[model samples]
Target chain A: MNLIGISINHRTSSLELREALHLNRDEIVSLIPLLKEQIFSEGVVISTCNRTEILGFPQTEGLDVNSIIGSLLQAKPIDGIKPEYFTRFFSCGAVKHLFSVASGIDSMVIGDSQILGQVKEAFEISEDLDFAGSISRRIFDTAIKVGKRAIKETTIGEGAVTVSYASVQVVEKIFANLEKKSALVIGAGESGELAAIHLRDKGVGKITISNRTIERAEKLAEKVHGEIVPFQFLKEHLHNFDIIISATSSNELIIHADEIKTAMKKRKGTPVVLMDIAVPRDIDPDVRKIDNVFYHDMDSLKIIVDQNMQKRKEQIPLVEKIVMEELVGFFNWYNTLDVVPTIKSIRSFFEEIRLDELEKIKNKVSDEDFTKIEDMTRRMVGRLLHNPTVKLRGFAESGANIKEVLTNTLILKELFNLEDFPTNGKSDAEENHNSEGNDEKN
Target chain B: MSQTITTLNVLLPLLYLTSFTVYLYDFFKEQKAVGNVNRIILFITIIVHVSYLLALTVEYDHPPITTKFEIFSIIACSIAFSYFILELLTDIRGTGAFIILFSVVFQVISSIFIGPNYKVPEVLRNRLLGLHVISALLGYSGIIISAVYGVLFWLLYRNLKENKFGLIFNRLPSLEILEKLSYYAAVIGFILLTLAIVIGIIWLPKAFPDFSYFDPKLTGTLFVWLVYGVGITSKWIANLYGKKFIIFSLIGFIVAIASLIVTNSLARTFHSFY
Candidate 1:
């Protein structure tokens, strides 16, 4: 309940201010220690191209927004970034924001997967700096899990959003085990280079680049860890590649249907994917009529990308539901942290009465009988306190209004006169039953 | 034993229906939790179907291939069993409901009208003859499954080509994998059909002196076998694959079902033994 977060994300600031406010690794390392020294008991600094957030538990009664910014400025001074540019979140707001950010719902490119990795790396940095406590670790770990669950339970991250990536995705739909497949990117233009890079990132076994100028082809091939083939020999070598992407400026068709037909003959009916990303259309569209050839021009790839983007947009509600579920689970654990101490106090109050009463009957019976009476009274007190203890913990971890739970805790403390009872001795009843109570909550 | 067989005969269709329902739900709704439940239900149904067939064989004193309806039930069980194995091996569950629906229909027809033939001929009760019929039924089951996958492949291929992006396109596996599975099923069918034909060629003449090689059932089966043989051979040599190969496999399946219908209902053949 003592959490607070300071964020200068894309939503709250201009690109110029965000750039100035962004903290690198060395900057975050220096700033975290200062923030810990001045204000936070525990904290994590998440800095990425889109956002830089500092989430922490405040050490004192008053949280000064300026002091936190001052600490940041001390670590890495910015020219004109003002305190008004940073948005602040408190308590449940902070927790919800963290979950949404990790789940990619709050991303600039909604469902940008890199944000989840950035969140995890921030947590690791906090842990490495000994700034992450148990509570901080649990919250961050829960955020990571929420991110994963969102991806697994919804289609938010499915398909390709970029044109070059869409070309690779089309090939993937027709082929499995990309590591066993080969690729050929013709022309070595910017689009062709991007296509080759995407294919290489997908672990395609071999990539061959062909261009009119050998110098550009060699440069791109080396960058993608691929081989270069002379542009004139592309027709003869088409059968060796399972995927072919053409992106060139030529107005004339660089790849013809007859050449592809010849390749399919020697390839023995194996499937081939051809992506023509050029503005003027490099590969012949008629190649799609071949038996095992799947051909896609830029228009088709754009349609696929647009459809995928729409699908991701439709999945926002599902991802938000996942974030809500994880937030509730996190609050259950967070609320239990408050309830455990109160539970211990209530048990101590009851044990005090039971032991005091047992002493009154200590001398009225034989030693064996006294032992039996003591055992019976202990069981009686345990059974009497069991339901209330469980109910109290349940009310706390139920993720209801925090004020309501706190009021109930106050009423229990006042009703039992638990404040007068010392919280040290004869509290064995709680430890025995607390695990069962917590297990039921979980 | 007859009582157990009767109970199982009634229960088998219901189990197949349940498996198909759950699988259909999983395919449409994409519920992973329910998908697991569907597989377990399917596994139990297959086990129960096997038990039913065993009980029927024990009670009737021969394999459950004596009548056309009985063979329908056997083919139903074989299809379900083969599809279950394919689902397990490939980890592809989208096509399971479509495949299992065939089992549900066949088993329902079997449960409604099929009964034990007490007057089956002694020659039909031979173990070698039982093997031949069972193998033939299994081969037909494989062909049926291959045909189903081929249909799915064609549907998905059309969806992709037209850029429809509908539920069928989203749910079905990739075109390449579907084509591979269809080809694999065809190969399995061709092998099993060859075994059945070889067994029949060795045993049929010695058992029946008047057995005619030109019997309607014999010629029909030979035609079905030769169609698949040619299809498989063309795939290897002539590079007939992809959508073309799938179309060919589907034609072979249609020819097979036509042969079954003609030999059973239209023609007077030597296979009628009851």
Candidate 2:
């Protein structure tokens, strides 16, 4: 599978450029239908504040991924937007990049667990659009595991000083007239609690702390006098809150910036100061440049400690370690996955041969003898396949693309008919037949 | 209660300073081993600080926040403790070490004139007075820490702006997080300061009979209060902060500390629980 990643990450780029390039959820929905027009196998959209990446499983006869991006954005010109915004494509590189990004290895702050959820949500949206399939599912799930591993293995962000507090200042910097307003802290952790505490002391009349774990957020809510509210109820109760500081550490950018903008738009542009303290940051930074949608980071809690510059310095080594290890680990595992379908196809063909031969001789054999023959056939196939499976798995685990090696080895030419299986991952003929039969019932 | 008193003018503050030295060493050295050592040493110092407070509490038969000397020392102690918690939570190692060092120095300086509040009659003890005293002192601790962060932010901003230093900036998260943290901390400080000042003003007529008007402590506190007020207003209203705001924060710390010293020297305040 060919993977093309188009992203605008923590690089310096204007919002206008990003907007011209970015695909809103609705736009992505429209584009998903468009992808049915392309030969790409599967697709997912990840629009974070720092970056907007589209990971596509392209056909082997790969065309420009930009057409997908352009078609999504409707061919709008992004002014002076550097090539830096867009990253490289991959035969299987997107999986590794995604694993690292979701794992917090690629995050500004290492050990931030929120990116996993943001990634999952993007996949979810893709799934809703009927685009995300096995690869998306496996890759996104692995991303979560990688994130959990970062937290478990390192103290990259041990103190969990979320930068949600900084988002408040972003608002303060923008409006400079916050005395009349209140802020809602949507989730409590290092970021939400800190934001609420800041707002409370800002003499804000209201400071509400809502969290998936409302009980956990109670102390902060009571301390800040924002009141305790459940996370489930937020959608309905959101109208009452003005500034929503969401730091739930959810995988998705839970509060879509557009949701806030729309909510505020209906209410005389009530400034919804959304500070994301969960890394990959809670706030979609894109929302900040949006009209009246003040946003902030899920950066480190350096703000509360006040010695952040020094602290960030201290965290460098740990972050580097996390990023490096994840990079290596991801490359290995991704390469292994790349070789999987070939292995599966090879195994399928052998099984198909064995089944056909058995069926051909069934009438000539006794039932008991047939069972024995089947077991012997399976053992023989396994013995023959053991070396390649073992070697390929080892290569894939270390971020080596075994499929490339297999291609060079001409294993495809020797053992199988490449056209029948289709390198672009066309559904196996049997699956197509089965699905077609199922469809006939409908 | 008076039985524990020996009138030993003090060598303890010096010892705390020594402890601060250890914490400083731990903070700047960039070693986890050093942090472990510092945590141990700071833990001991915390014990010492708590003991000092407890001993005084027994001698005076109240919380240690009963005298200017005790208040200053306790505030320093509280700051150290709170900072440790923050460090442990954030796992941001060296920053807490420096803060502890600063706390140690502040405590040492304030300890020389560590004015202890004498016993008060039952009539002087009220809920508001207690809240006023504790919150005010806590506010002092928070502000002191905030000022430290302000200094860090200023240093960071300067380094980035002038290219004089980037090590600290590079090591640090984005300047935005530091500035945001400073703002949040100052806000919390303001809440406590406001609470403290409000109660101080309300009780003046009853607490000090001859003082129907405002006193030096009142004025000094008002000045700090104004600084916090401006800080808060500017954040919410204009979202502006820079060297000026940092300077204001530093000034707030200086003024608040000075007035606290002056007030303690002048009278044994019911609110003097450092």
Candidate 3:
């Protein structure tokens, strides 16, 4: 079996190209059968917002990369993009890439945890379509294990790697508990919505959303289970909130230093965290210097995000070590698969020769002598074949190079004149047939 | 029995020291596995502590409250017991290091100062008095823990207000949780202290006809009770909370500690049996 992968990620492609090539759940499901027929025996398609990877095990060697890419592009065609934009990996590299991707190291946001779930969903889809067989199953399962291990054993997935999540983390650092804290989200934009959602997820007791338009604020509030506040009342009620996240599209500053100072005066020294996660910032920068007012703009949040990213990057070697260990385990088990059929073929070839010799000698002797002779020959065959069988198993268990084992297997087969042996070795069937023939003959 | 008590005396302190170290390690390292290990160590320490107290009771042929050393041992056990229950209920292991360190200190002090064969006074031999003393010790344990929580809350609140996002900020529970914990512990302390004082008052004349109502320990007890009473009542009725309540609880505990020390040192009260 030959594992193969083709990927187009944030590092290799532009956002437009990635979007053009992106596959949804339905698209991925439709592509599964085509991928199997056009490229490999088993296939899995992992398509997330940041990356799209088609990983499979080819049924045969010398499969054309261009042809596989052509098939994929044909299934989901994008204009003006060549197959060269996608990066390809062969067997070991393919497996390692999948493991790394599942572990979130290859994600756009290095330690974002969403990629693991995406990978699982992709694998489940492949499983539902019967496109993933035992090898794919083992690979996906091992990838998931590596993902969980990377999260559990190391700090790769520890901190928030996004600005929105970092804002919530800042609140967590300041307040230590969000259960009793209230948050106000200004401007109903994506970043503001994300911040509010994160605060809600962290169990912040109350959340209010305010936008220039009350309808938009109400919509976002409904989504985050927060109450809608009119934009005019935002500054007036700022003292009531412990955390304030502002992400508006307005060019001018929405919250000025004077208003914040007034709010602080009313807060009676209770600290308030203000996160301005917007371009051209929604809050005045001078407000950060105010006492009892913890103000962080996008740059400050970016510093936290960058620090978290750096921390996760430092854990790459550790995660890579874990992945390498898991790879060795998988390869060892896979090497055993390559040797098992060869071992069986050798055993059956010897068994057939012994049975043919026994048949020739059966009628040449008296009944009692024939019985004793047959028993003796059977014991001799067993003893003679035992050492080579044990040695072959030892070679397999020792995790020797698969190519060397296959070469040795070929030499053994040639030396035994077993060239006519079945390519798909039906060893179990032959063993059963031999035993039944022996019983009838006796 | 005496040999077993001796063995327990050494074993319990060593166990408590190990628990203290584990909790400290967990506090700094912040690993889930280390936290789990700390929990198990603390649990084992508590079990051994209870066993030691049982061995002491067996050796003395009564509850082990006859000597200052025995009372200290009970105090140490009560602190650990209350902390263990809090940990179980809150699943907050960050405060374990501080609480367990205090327990170790108390156990060490008890072991060093309270000898194995101290004499019991005639006035303290009454079972009711023993109950009162044990109840008061447990109550003091509750108050002490509440005071620690109060201190942590103030430290956290101050750090947040100052934007000092340091170790204490990350490790301790949130301000609201700490405040609630302090309030709960203070309530428990208050109820137990009430029980101790009431029992003391009802049995005061029966035990000692010459016992004065104005004795230092009794008067000190009443004063601490009134302080905690005012604190709790203010929190409930007058919306006194946050830093105000935290400061009140800490002051109340400090007064209680002062009462204990002054009454013991001055020997102007019959309650100072040691």
Q: Which candidate achieves the best TM-score against the true structure?
A: 1
Measured by lDDT, the strongest candidate is: 1
* lDDT-better candidate, 1 vs 2: 1
Which 10-residue span in candidate 2 chain B carries the lowest summed lDDT? B1-10
Instruction: Assess candidate 2 and give its lDDT.
Output: 0.63
Q: What interface RMSD does candidate 2 have?
A: 10.7
> Which of the numbered candidates is closest to the native, going by highest DockQ?
1
Off by over 4 Å in 3: A6-45, A57-88, A123-133, A152-155, A170-183, A200-207, A225-227, A235-243, A251-307, A314-318, A343-398, A401-404, A407-442, B60-68
lDDT of each: 0.86, 0.63, 0.82
Supply fnat for every model shown.
0.46, 0.00, 0.19
Kindly list the per-residue Cα lDDT of model 3 for residues B114-160, writing each as its tens digit: 66654556666588977897788888888999999999988887775
Docking class of 1: acceptable
lDDT of 1 at A441: 39
> For residues A1-442, could you state the per-residue lDDT of candidate 3 as single tens digits?
4788899999888999888889999998888888777677888988877888888877778888877778778788888777778899988999999999988888887767889889999999999998977767878899999999989898889877889998888787667567788899998888888898899899999999999988989999998889988998777898899999999998999999999899877876667889999998889988877765778877777766777788789889988999999998777656656555555566668778878988998888899998898788777777776777666655755676777878877788778766666536444323432333232222
lDDT of 2 by residue, B1-274 (tens): 3333333225456656666776666544544555476676667777767677677766666666555456667678778876776666655554564577666666776667765466666544566676787788678777877787788876755543332322464344434455555666678788988888778778766766676345556667888889778867866786554555666677778877788667767664443434
Which scores higher on DockQ, 1 or 2?
1
Query: Model 2: what TM-score?
Result: 0.40
Candidate 1 runs further than 4 Å off: A10-21, A30-42, A58-87, A127-134, A152-155, A187-194, A211-224, A230-236, A247-253, A265-269, A278-281, A306-318, A336-442, B1-7
Task: Give the lowest summed-lDDT range of ten residues in model 3 chain A.
Answer: A433-442
